[model samples]
Each structure stands twice: as structure tokens, then as C-alpha cells.
Target: MTEIYQKLENIVKKEFISNSLIVRHAYSRVVDPVLQGIPDIVIRPKDAKEISEILKVANEENIPVIPRGGGDDEFGGSKPIGDGGIVLDMKRMDNVLKLDEDNLIVTVEAGISWGKLDEYLCHYGLYTGCMGPGSGMTASVGGGISHQSVGGGGCAKYGACTNQLVSLEVVLPNGDIIETGSQANKFSKIPFNRFGNGPDLAGLFCGDNGIMGVKTKVSLQVFPRPPFAAYKTFLLPRKDRQVSSQIMLDVRRKGIDVYDLMYIMDLIMRVGCDQGMFPMWEQLKKKRGIIFYTVEANSEAELQEKVKQLDTIILDNKCEALGPEISDGNIAKWHYVEQGHWQFYHNLWGMVPALEPLSCECFVPANMYPTILDDIDQWDMEHAKDMEIFTKVTGMRPITGSGPIFLIDGNNVELTCGFTSFPSYYNGENHEGWDELNLKLWKSLMGMLTTKWGVQWYMMGEMASRIMAQLDAYLPDYYKTLKAIKKVLDPKNILSRGKFEFWGDGNK
Candidate 1:
């Protein structure tokens, strides 16, 4: 153990206590950066060789390891559970390898932040061209690929990070390095699209939340900057949310162009934004209990055309326009979100409770969206309490590229609702009245989604394991085969453990 620590210290080059502190803290606790659970040791490798040497030792010792990057992942991606294992901090490996402008692709070390890549590409007038969280800030290329982080900016153009991936250099459990695709090539590259051939490995790491192996280097496709952007707002008159939601669906069903960034702000979000703290929500409440929209177009002419159709749909649905629209306001409200005002989007709720689970998220078709979410909400109201939802990606694939639109993506639009269930005792109603009862009701309602409506939960978390059992009866042989491949790639079970477990131990 002394020898291991010495070697780790050498790799990280810490000659004193202060130097050791650099290796101790993870960015997850940045606000409380000096709090509990400091890492046993931090190994910062400048290259993959140094990583292999450290990993070999850790493996031989049977010590657990945590891979880290930008120190984000709201789901707690970078947190370590090691009894006394080391953190293989990847940030030191940061390097931009190649930028193929002609191919619209860029390659970089796993530690390179999204913002760094964006700045590098922008010099040449290009980008990874995906809807992602905070391209101007720090987020490793590998971490982005791992979480499949999708945000507002690129939803209309690039989709998720997986869609932009052209190739990767992955180091498997045995420390064997293998390339997945060409420098800028994929298995499914047609005249216009790139597809993963022979079992798309990108999907394996994309959103795996780093349970398999540490990502070393990645190659991704970029895009040219678009010209002309606009935001439009509307007020659905129907105090009945169902009526308004159905109307929104109707507009999409007719194949009319709509907002790239779209959603229905609930009363909680309505109330929170109304406090004048969140500018977006404040502007949004103008259309109380109504639909608000922001549209992006190629030019002014196309913009006017889409708006004309939107106006027609609004009038037909008995919804009316609100005063002081987004076009007039420059739609600066979205920045509140990009700048980390998520609570604004949460309706009236504050920080989302850790243990809160609503009913199953069912991605019913757009036609069924209003009715489905509304019915679910009513069930929770009468049967339990309040709700929250994210509805989109029915037939209207506003996200133009490939990958998951709805974890609820088959026959439905994906929506989620939760009743507040705070972990600790707070001053007043941390979880009083409806909040307390809803926790119990949320459980029963979820069961109903599975047995009754066949509603699904996005398989991005611990719940995925439960779904896998139910799916085995319905899954094809290929899925079993994929599980086998997962076992081989991650023999030690060192990857996104339990979160998105792709392996079945009994199978082996």
C-alpha cells in the first residue's frame, strides 16, 4: 500500500501536503469541495501508458477504481465508492489531436472540455453540432459521450453526442487499445448519414456513466454555424392543460415547423418564474396555463411562414397570443437555464428531492400526449398529488439526428411527474401534506404504469435493472448476445455499475 501511494504520488507529482490536496477533492463537492469522502489517492496520467501501469496495479490488488472528468454528472457521476481505491483523474490527459474541417470531424483526449473543443473548432468556424449542456464551459469529450448529455442548443441540429461520433479509441479492461471507426468514419456511413456497424459500440459508452472502462480519446463530427435564430411565445387560453397540450400536438401533427426548443411550463415552473427571479419563467407566465414556444429558422422568410401556420393553429385550438412575445424580447430567458436556473423549469419546486419518483414515463404518441400526461396527473391528484413532465418527440422529431428522442420513444412522447419527497426534516413543509402522501402513492402509480399502461421509465438509472427482468421475456437473442459482449468488455464489472447494468452474471 505504501509503495502504491508513493507511485501514485510520483505520477501526480505531489511533494507536499498541499500537492496531495489536488488529488483529494472531486469537483462534485466544489460548492462543498472540502467536505466528506476525500479520495484515498489520485493518479493523474499524462498519457495512456501511465494509466495502464496504475490500472494493472489496482487490478492486481482488487481495488475499486473511479474514472473522472469535468467533475459533473448531476446523477453523481464522479463520486467514488472505493473502499480505498484511487481516482484515475483523466483531466491531465487533455489534448486536441485532430480537426478535420473537410470531414467536419475533430478528435481529442477524453479530458478535453466541450468548451475547449468549441473554441478550437470555432477558430475554423465549426462545432460538434449537437444539443449539449454548456458548450462554453468545462466538460470532457469522454464525459459528454458517456452521459449522452443533450441540451437545448443542439436539439434541432446535432441531437446527442452519440449522433456526432464518428470514431473512438477505447482501452478495454485488459488494457488492449482498439479503434472503433475511421478517423472520421463510422460503420454506417452512407451518402449523408453515419451508422455504427457490427454492434455499435458508441451506444455502449454513450450514457453508460462510466461503468465499463476509462475513455481515452474520441473522434466526433462538427458542423458549420447556422444563420438566423428566433424565439416565439404563445398563450394557450385553456386553463385545462390537456386541451392546450392536445392543441400543441395538433400543430405538430400537421407537419408545420415549430420551435427547436419547446415545452409546457407547469404551475410550479409558472410560479417560480413569476417571482421575477427566473427571467424565462417570468416572461413565460404571460401565457398563463398556456403554451409558449421558441422557433428557429434559416431565414426571415421561412420564419414568417412557420409563425403564420403557428398562429393559425393557436386560433383554431382556442388559444390566443400573449403580450410582449419572444421575438420582441430577443428570448434571453433561455440563458437562465444554461446559466443553471434549473429550478425555474421545475414549476414551483426547489431542488429536486433525491428519493422522489413519480409514475412511469410513458412516451405515448403526440395525439395521446395531452390525454396521457393529463390522465396520469389526474390519477396522481386524486390518487396521490402533483406532477412534472417533459413532453416531446412524438412524430415531430424536432431533433433531426439519430439517437433516443424519448427514452419513452416508441409509440409515445416521454413525460415525467414527481411528488416532492425531501430526505431531511426542514423548517416547514419539507414534505408536508400532499408531498408526504404522494411518496407512497408514487409507488402504486408506477406499478400501474408497468402492469396497466405499459408506460416506461427512461433506462438511464438504477431502475434499468428492474426493466431488464421484464424485458427478457420480450427481448430477442441479439440482446442476449449484447449482454455477453458487455461481460467480455467489462469482466471485472468496473463500469457504470448498477446504473445501466448491461451484464447478467448468471449468463456466464
Candidate 2:
């Protein structure tokens, strides 16, 4: 290991390589409470060339190379799960390489934060079409692309990270550089298109979670920043989950250009009310769900016209408007805190008051939302009884949480619905046992989601890998093909070794 570390230092300079216990420990910890893997060494390469050299060395020596960006992976995708290996930290490569306003695209280094890219583009009256996750402030563009993250702005209109991507420059496992998308053309000057002459190679790497290769540069589609934006909120009556789901489906089917739509359940609202985080809590305490919409347009007139149309849909669906004051205030607060190197969602941690928060997210079809929610509610009721009693007796908060599902796309018959659970504690005396139980329950729930609910999408990390493996029996060829592709691209299994391994190579 010492000899390998010395060789790595020579590849990217001694200052860029670290084998210190503290550094390795920091690299090991992920957002999950219990999932952790310590790497033997960490390397911060300056560019794709440096990364290529590092990969070459690792591949030749048959050492695992885990490519990481931001290191904010909640699913343990960037962690070193195999025997201790090298963590290729990509943060040092942060830079916006180009902003082609004429072509309506921006080329950026893989390590650049989504927040930084948005801030830089705002000055030029442009923004990326697909916004990032809650951790956008710290999450890198490559990391989001690798994970295919959802949420943020424009998701309702533009879909997820892969939808915004136009091209990518990646370093393969054997130290070979390749450009995908329109950029692959020898005469291409800009990455304005996604599909080129042949196969869409860029699409292959989008959500693979770093198992395929190391992305060094990314080109994404950007849109003109809307000058006028409108916000509205509606309260769905309790006992009308079907009606609530139907209303959203109608709004989506109507082709309303909703920039952002968030469905906050009653449980989340109650928690926010107790934490004093939401000012409209008093007015909406009894509501079954709160639906928030942010619509943007080129002019105030256009924005008002869209809002008027949305109003009719809300009224026709028997939903009550929460008024502009409450709705706009909440939207403004989120924007203010999330813009410019901000971490708005961090405040939610205070409510859970946990050292580390554990969450499980899944993407189910839009039509399945109500049924899935009902199933989860039943599961929570049955499983949370013991934790509730334990917390009550110990003077600690119970392990309770909520799942917020948002519709990403509406044009397709099978719309994408992103469901995320609120954070829960997994620490403290006596709580450790509950934590283990909760983890097991969460994993089982994930399995059920993919199997019973027909969920077809997942976020990056080890959980996704496990879910894929769990569902492999239903799609043997799909898993086999993925493994075959992995073998071809990374023959030595050096890059992100044991990650997304569905071939039964002892990774599971």
C-alpha cells in the first residue's frame, strides 16, 4: 500500500495524494448513518490527462479507483466498497470551460457545483434547464449527472439531469479519453445536440454512478431565465388522496409550464409547524396535503395568464387556494436561502436533531402515487409503534418521517414521480437498535417499491445497486448485459470496483 501511494503521488504530484488516517476517514463517511468505506488513499487530479495517468497506473496494478465529486453521496455511490483503494477526488477540476450563449449551452468541468454554474449563468440571463437536488449548493454537476438527480427548478418542465446533458468528456478505465454526443464529431464546434451520427454514447454514462468511466467535462442545455415568476399553493382536503392525485395529473396533462411543483404531505406540514419553519402552518394544519407551484414566463402578462389558467384547474378540482401572500412568501424564502452558495434544506436537520439523517427515495409512475403512499403509510404505522414507545419513554423524538412526491414529466403516459422520505435519526443509546431495524425496514421497502410498484428509476449509490440486483431475477438479461458492459469497459474491475455489481462477483 505504501508503494502504491508513492506511485500515485508521482502521477499527480505528492501534494495531491494523501494516505493520512484523517483524510481517509473523511473520505469514507457518507450521508448514510451506517454505510461507510475507508479508502486506502485519496488523489485530487488537476485535469483529464492527470486522471488518465492515475487510472492507467491503477489499472495496471489492479487497484480499485473510485471517482468522486463533492463527496455528498447519500447512497454510498462514491465510497470505496472493495478492498481499500484510491479515491479520485474531482473537486480540484472545478471550472466552467465555456458558455456558448449563441448555442444555448454551457460546458463545465465535472467538479463544478450546480449552484455555482447557476449563479454564473444568472448574470447572463440564462440557467440550466434541469435543476439539481437539495444539495445543489455543494453537489457537483458530474455527481448529479452520475446520480441522475431530480428536483430544484425546471424539473416539472425539463425532467432530470440526463435531460439537460448534451455531451460529456470521459476517461475510461484503461486511461483512454473519449468524447460523447455531438462533440464526438471531428468538425463539431459546439455541443448543442445530444444525438450525433451513431449511438448516443453520452446517454450510456449519465446514470451509471461512476462505474463506466470518470467524467471530466460536461455540456448541458441552458435556457433564458424567465423575467416573471408566479407562485401558488393549494390545500387538498383530507381523505381525498385520489382527488389530489387526479388534480395534479390534470394540471400536468393540460401542459402547464410549471417550473417547480412540490407536494408537501400533512405530516411534513405538521413537523414544520412544530419547528416553526413554516409561517402558513396555522392555516394549513388540517389540510391533507399542500401543493406548491412555481410558474415562470417572459413577461408579467404571460405569467398572470398562466396563473389564471391554473386557478381554473384548481377550482374545478375542488381545491382551495392558500392565497398569494402565503404561497409567494414560502417560495421567496426557499429561493433566498438556496441561491448563492446557500444550503436551505440544511435547516431541516434541526427538526430531526440527528447526527446523521437516513432517507430512502424512489421514482414510481405518476398513476401509482396514491397506492404507494397508502402502502407506505400502512407500513409506517405498523413498524413505527415500537420506536414511538421507545422515544416516548426515553424523552426523545420518535422516528417519524414523510414522503414528498413530485411529478417530473407529464407528456408521457408513464410520468416520473420522485418520492423522498424525510430524515430520521440513527444514533444515540438504545436508538442504535431502532436504527438497525429502520435500515432493514427501509431496504425492504425499497425492494417492494421496485418489485410490486413497478418503479423503474433510482438515484445513484449502493442502495440503487442493491435494488437492481434484487430485481435482477425479473430482468436477467438486463443485469447480464450491464455486467457484460462493465467487463468490456473495465476489464480489470478497477474503476468503482464492486459498485453496481449485478454479476454475483461477491460484491453483494
Candidate 3:
């Protein structure tokens, strides 16, 4: 390991590489309470060429190489699945390479955060559609593309961040650097399209979860920010879950061009208000579920028409409108004008101190979520006995529910459903058996959500990806084809090894 560390140091100067225990320990964990893996070395490469050299060395040594961007991923996608390997930190490569305003395209180093990129684009009155992810303040563009991420503003209009992709520069597991999209043509001077040269190979790297290759550079289409905009929030009647789901379906069915539409469940409203997480809704007499909409347009007429259509759908469903001001429970105004999207998308995770989330993010049809949400309630009841173990120790039962249901592209919605509980090391004490119980409950919930609900998981990281593979959740031919592709692109399985049971020979 020391010799390998020295070899990596030679690739990315000694100052940028570390084998210290403290540094490796820091790279081992992510937002999850689980400690996924420990790294033998952590190296930050400044460019694709340096990453190419590092990958070559790792391939020769048959060592695992995990590419990490920003380390803001909650799914453990950037960490290794084993005890020791090299964690390639990509933050050093953060830079905007180009901005072709004429063509409405912006090229950037993959490690650049969405917030930084947005700030840069805002200077020119442009923005990246889908604005990366809910954690876009620090989540890297590479990580967002790797997961087809959503939940940020404009997801209703732009879908995933990958939807606007024009090109990508990826370093394969075997150290070969290749450009996808129009750049695949050797003589092409600029990347303007994603589908021309041969296949849409850029897609192979998108949402690959760090298994196919390391993303180094990316080019995405930028949209001009509209001048006309309007937002509204509505309080729902009883049976809010079913009612909220219907509102989302109607918004899609009526062809409403909304920028953002979200369903905040009653649990979040009540708990968030009680915990003071939602100051805007403090005065609401009924803390039931609420739905909000944000719309933007090139003209005031278009914006008004969209708002009028949306208001009719929301009001006809027996919902009461909050005041136009954000202070009067109008969260949509704050979400758009004040940049509250990043802060509130995952607020439920911090509803209680020291309670961490074991969550699953997935896409499901708008109509199916009400049933899924109800099933989650039933799931909570079924797990009451197991939850009591935590309640006995901490006097607080684990809280299980779905966070805000975000209306994403098409007729789908993004569901961030999970339970939060005290970590095994709560209050700085290691409680035996707590870790095992947490894993057991997490796996069980994941199994139920996947098998019974048939939801499509977009960000299956170390734990969820492995559990899905182990549970035989995927069809036989689909699994076989994925393995074949992995074998072809990553023969040694050195990149993101052990994911989907693709551990390299003798490594398992």
C-alpha cells in the first residue's frame, strides 16, 4: 500500500496525495450513518491527464479506484465498497472551460459545483436547466450526472441535469480517455449535439454510479432565465396524500408548463412547524399537507395563463390558497425568489438532532405515489416492534415517512422516502447491536420499496445497489447484459468494484 501510495503521489504531486490514517478515515464515510469503506490513499488530480495516469497505475496494480466529486452524495456512490483503495477526489479539477453564449452551451470541469456554475451563468442571464440537485450548493455536476439527479428547481421543466448534456470527457477504467457526443468525431471542432457520432455513448457514463468511468469534463445546454414568473402555494383538504397526488397528475395532464411543483406531506408540515424548520407556515391553523407551483415564461401573458390554469386545478380540488406573500405560508415564492429550494428539499433529515436518514431516492408515476406513501405508513406500523429498540434506548421512535414529492419530468415524481433514527454511536457511545439492527431495517425497507412498489431507483449507491443485486430484483437478461457491459468497459472491475456484485477476480 505504501508503494502504491508513492506511485499515486508521482502522478498527482506529493502535496495533493495523502496516505494518512486521518485523511483516509475522512474519505470513508458520506451522509449516511453507515461507515461504508476506508481508503488506503486519497488523491486529488487536477486534470483528466493526471486522472488517466492514476487509472493506468491502478489498473496495473489491480487496485480499486473510486472517483469522488464534492463528497456531497448521500447514497455512498463516491466511496469504495471495500476496506482499502484509492479515492480520487475531483475537487482540484473544478473550473469552467468554456461558455458559448451564441450556441447556448456551457462547458465545465465535472468537479465544479452547481451553485458555482449557476452563479457564473447568472452573470450572463442564463442558467443550467434542472440546476443540478437539491444539494446543488456543493454537489458536483459530475455526481449529478452520475445519478440523473433531480429535486432542484426547474426539474419539472428540465428533468435531470443530464437532460441538457451535449458532451462528456470520460476516463475509462483502463486509463483510456474518450470524448462522447459530437466530440466523438475526431475532426469536430465543437460539441453541439449528443446523438450524432455512432451511439449516444455519453449516456453510458451518465448515471453509471462511478462504475463505467470517471467524468472529467462536461458540456450542457444553458437556457436564458425568463423575466416573467409566478408562484403559488395551496393548503389541501383532508386525505391530503391522495389529493396532493391528484393535483400533480392534473398538472401534467393539462399540459401546464410549470417550472417546479411539489407536494409537502402532512408529516413534514406538522413536524417541520413544531421543530421550527418551517417558519413560513407557523401561523397556519391547519398544518396539513400543502402543494406549491412555480412557473416561468418569456411573456407575462404566458406566465399568467399558466398560473391561471394551475390555480383552477388546485382550487377545484378543494384546496385553500395561502397569501401571495411568503410570510403567509406561500413557500413557492421563497423557493423561487430566495433560493430556498436547496435548503428545504431535505429538511426532514434534520428534523431532530443526531437523527440520520437511511433514504432511497427514486422515480415513480405521479398517480402511484399516494399508494406508495400509504404503504410506507403501513410499513412504519409493521416495523414498530423493531423501532421500539431505538425508542427504548433514546425515548424517541424512529420517524419514517416520505419527504416532499417533487414533480419531475414527464409524468413522474421524485420520492425521497426513508426513516431517521439515532446512529449506533449516538451521544458518542457505541451501542452494541444497534448497527446490525439498522442495517437489517434499512435493507428490509429497501426491499419492500423495490419489489412491491416497483419504483425506479435513480441513485442506488453502495448499499442500495448491492442489496438490489443480491435480492435478484433485476430480471435475468437485464442483469446479464449489465454484467456483460461491465466486463467490456471495466474488465477488471477496478472502478467501483463490488457494485452490483461485479467484484474483480480474487477481490471478493
Specify the highest-TM-score model's number: 3
**Quality of model 2 by C-alpha lDDT:** 0.72
Worst 10 residues of 2 by lDDT: 412-421
Reference-based lDDT, residue 165, model 1: 78
Cα lDDT, all candidates: 0.51, 0.72, 0.88
- lDDT value, residue 371 of candidate 2: 78
TM-score of 3: 0.98
Candidate 2 C-alpha lDDT tens digits along 227-302 = 8887777777764556656766877878888776666667766766676766655655463677667788898889
Model 2 TM-score is 0.91
Better of 2 and 3 by TM-score: 3
- What local lDDT does model 1 show for residue 86? 64
Once fitted onto the true fold, the runs of candidate 1 whose alpha carbons sit more than 4 angstroms away are 10-12, 15-39, 81-84, 92-95, 119-124, 134-139, 183-199, 239-259, 280-287, 290-292, 323-372, 375-421, 425-482, 500-508
Which number leads on lDDT? 3
Tens-digit lDDT track for model 1 on 314-361? 677776555553333323234222333122223222333232223233
Which portions of model 2 show Cα errors greater than 4 Å? 280-288, 326-329, 332-344, 385-394, 397-401, 411-435, 471-474, 503-508
